[model samples]
Target: MPSLNVSFSDEEMEGVRAAAAAEGKSLKQYLHDLGVREMHRKRFVAGATAWADKLRGEFDEAFPEEIPPAQRGDGAAAA
Candidate 1:
């Protein structure tokens, strides 16, 4: 329902047209799909980052003062 106007250099326009033809799409359809995929990618990254941060916080709370395995002196010290 909405429209966007974009300009490209001659070389860039040719490259875009070539890519659309290679994918069996018109330039409009190719650009539209590219935009949709980029939107989804950004949302996925944001959600994944939030989930990782929450898990990290919980882990830190559960393991305050926990020594990493590499820093632990030896198997005997671990026991």
Candidate 2:
């Protein structure tokens, strides 16, 4: 795999080093984990947004208020 060169301030580098040391990981491994986590989070949000849009379209196509907020579990505790 190809590597990209990035520059950061001395303070930033120190912070990364300290964090990696605390976690018992090399700086490279720490950065790799961070990047992977962010990518995973973005992919999850994209999937959820697509599903929500599809559901909204279906809800509109059916009845506007046929599915009430309470029935949809809108923040209320389930019975």
Candidate 3:
């Protein structure tokens, strides 16, 4: 694995150390988990957006009038 060098102010470093200790993780492990979780969160959002767009397009093509009155269950068009 590649190594990364990051700089932090003393206060910042102390805060990070405290946070890691609170979570029962070393600073390295805490940062690693944080990075991995952020990456997964971004990927999930992108995928969900794409899936929602596809579904919206399909739905618009199928129901241009916004769900059609017959399927509304109001029984006004049940004849």
lDDT against the true structure, each candidate: 0.90, 0.85, 0.88
| Local accuracy of candidate 1 as per-residue lDDT tens digits, 11-43 | 999999999999999999999999999999999
Q: Report the CA-based lDDT of candidate 1 relative to the real structure.
A: 0.90
- TM per candidate comes to 0.68, 0.63, 0.67
Worst 10 residues of 1 by lDDT: 68-77
Off by over 4 Å in 3: 58-79
**lDDT, candidate 2, residue 67?**
64
Q: Which pairs in model 1 have colliding backbones?
A: none
Top-TM-score structure, candidate number: 1
**What does the lDDT read for residue 54 in candidate 1?**
78
Residue 45, candidate 2: C-alpha displacement in angstroms: 0.6
Worst 10 residues of 3 by lDDT: 70-79
With a 3 Å backbone cut-off (N, CA, C), the pairs that clash in candidate 2 are none
Top candidate, metric lDDT: 1
Candidate 2 lDDT for residue 24? 99
Error of 2 at 8 (Å): 1.2
lDDT measured at residue 42 in model 2 versus the true structure, 0 to 100: 100
